[model samples]
Target: MKLTLTLVTIALSINAVFAQKTNPNYDPELATELKADDYGMKTYVFVILKTGTNESKDEELINSSFAGHMANIKRLVEENKLIVAGPMLKNEKNYRGIFILNVSTIKEAELLLQSDPAILEKFLEPELFLWYGSAALSEYLEASDKIWKTKY
Candidate 1:
């Protein structure tokens, strides 16, 4: 399943590259809003959430920790600090999930992550790095609200 998902991601990436080659149907205003570079890319803080060594055996603690963890995610999204976040399908390399922060600096991203219960409780550890991705990522919060009827 992981292999399949990886292949699908690769295929989609290739498709996007080719699709942009012909006519992008580009929007000049959106480009300005997103601060898109020549390649339509923008900087972000990429965070990898990994399983920490300090796991508690108590179910109650785990449940409470995860609840707060999710709440924090919602808060960040509402604040427009986090553009993307989701868990990985596989546990390869102890990686549990990811967070793509709409911030330019690691320090800013770290401060935000510090509020997560998962991080505080040692259920999750974060590794942050600078990343460049499609400027369209900056529009995800608004786009997601339009597409999904569910609210958190």
Candidate 2:
């Protein structure tokens, strides 16, 4: 009987040790605002901007389209729709850049991409996928704005 009680006690102790505990730093308000799950993560659309078939050598068109693209990026960021956007270095895949959009569906992301002049002009093509990442990812933009000396 003593051995049985000791074994049960050991089993209960092990279960307690392995049980999930609530995060000490968890912020319910922030999590709710961000639409985060219990793990503090939410869904986003990840876009890979690739070089498109529009290889026109027209410098004027290229310049104008790219300028509009940059402007579109700023506008989306201001609207809190685009959480991340940046160019990638030269690669074999012809990937030009990436954008992590703060949107839930691929259709929504496609609609937002339609606003980009680069995509409209066929200078860049987007391949989108649903991404699961930390809800606080957008918060980085606050500090990012302070650190950039030159406006892109």
Candidate 3:
């Protein structure tokens, strides 16, 4: 009878433990304080592709609305939302600028990027893509983020 009770207790304890999720970085207190308890970290990857027409149109769009787009990016940075954005070198083929957004999901990132004024210039639709289960944001932001956190 004692052994049966011990086994039952152990089983109940195991079940309880399994029911709870454990992740060190998940700070409920911070999330609640910020009023973003429902949000979690996600990767937003923007891939720049080489297209004859899009390259030129994108350049014009960027030149035309550089002020507005930059202001928006700065705001996002102030809000602790903007991850990183920059263009790949000219030498690189098929890919150009990549912006990594630590946002809600792929869809959320897409929606956010769509707000980019330069993107609305009838170009290649911003020509971005979503990456799931990624090993890491491209090498640039990884290095930049490290430097960023160190500075601030």
Candidate 4:
């Protein structure tokens, strides 16, 4: 299954390159908000899931933990604490499991990440990313509301 997913990612990347060649410059339809400095200082993390062995890989625990992760994100959104959150597709390879979230600071972001069942309980090793972008940050946050509302 994992191998199949990897092949799928490779195929997707090749297609994306060709898609770009024809279009050359497709942009995100969402509008961007450009408080670049402020947003840049803020931290956005991306988690890449490592392997899950044995008991932790049990379907129930994996599903339950994912729920907890989403529940935590929902709570943060309700409080207006999260700027954006979502799973990322594999770029060119299929090590594709993780989420991106925007928080006020790296410390706080790490704390929130550690709260996730996968990380907190040693269920998986996750990677982190502090993304840098101009207005893209705002666009993602805006799109995120729609995603949360199930409009996406």
Candidate 5:
């Protein structure tokens, strides 16, 4: 009888432990902001930045285009339309930069790219694709601020 009672107590304790991990009291606002799907993910637009024709080759034009490129990225980030943007370390295949837009449609992403001066000047080109990623990416932005001191 004592063994049966001890076993029952241990089983209840184990069940309680698992319950806390599985059933969390989540915030509704955050769930919506993340756009959590059934699997806690959503769609995004992924863009691959590549070297353009480089027809001009003029140093001034290149510099100006790059300046505009950075500014465009900043603008997208500020607007919350772009979630991730960065450059690759290697110049392989003329790969330059990348962007993950917080958009669901390719048409929307294309329009956003059109506003970039680099694209306008043909100094940088983009290859757009669709991506499915964690919706929490948006929420992590706030958490990231705690780890990084600089903005941008």
Candidate 6:
């Protein structure tokens, strides 16, 4: 049994080495434009928008703030600073949404978040973290723009 396990491990190791070979479709120019590292990944700032301490009963203020938040999102996307932004489904952690910013530092992310009206009004609070993900992620926005039937 031990000999069989050793043989299996050796086989897996050989497969891993073969899998690490350079991609046949590698595009150096695209990688450079996306700021991808050797592994085709880049640093980003991940933000979790959580329910804030404010419990304002004023509906008009809340609605206006959210409208401004949406506008801010649009501006950030156009600026190429926000690569991903979406609301989370109902969850136990009180997380309202998320934003994956095309930035390397928490400070930069904080500066970007300052433009969000919901955050300013204390309707939503942000928690930022450094994230590493595929540099090609922003490419999806182009295709996404084509598929949307209506603007929200």
Provide the TM-score for each candidate, comma-separated.
0.74, 0.95, 0.47, 0.50, 0.76, 0.85
lDDT of 5 by residue, 9-128 (tens): 999999888863532666667768778775568999999988887689789888888899899888998899989888887875888889999999999999999989888899888999
**Candidate scoring better on lDDT of 1 and 6:** 6
Candidate 1, residues 24-110, lDDT tens digits: the string is 777888889888886889899999999987768999889998999999999999888899999987866999999999898999998
TM-score of 1: 0.74
lDDT of 4 by residue, 1-152 (tens): 99999999999999988873333353334322333342233345545665444355478878887678678767776665555555546465435365555554556667777666755656655666666544455455666456554543
Candidate 5 lDDT:
0.85
What is the RMSD, in Å, between candidate 1 and the native fold over all Cα?
12.8
| TM-score, structure 6 vs. true | 0.85
Model 5 clashing-pair count: 0
State candidate 2's TM-score.
0.95
Clashing residue pairs in candidate 5 (N, C-alpha, C atoms within 3 angstroms) = none
Q: Considering lDDT, where higher is better, how would the candidates rank from best to worst?
A: 2, 6, 1, 5, 4, 3
lDDT of each: 0.89, 0.97, 0.57, 0.59, 0.85, 0.96
lDDT (Cα, tens digit) per residue for candidate 6, span 20-75: 67889999999999999989999999999999988999999999999999999999
Candidate 1 Cα misplacement greater than 4 A, ranges: 1-26, 142-152
Given candidate 5, what's the lDDT at residue 16?
88
lDDT of 3 by residue, 1-112 (tens): 9999999999999999888666678777755543343443334555453322445645555676555666767676665555666656767454545666656466776767
**Candidate 6 weakest lDDT stretch, 10 residues:** 17-26
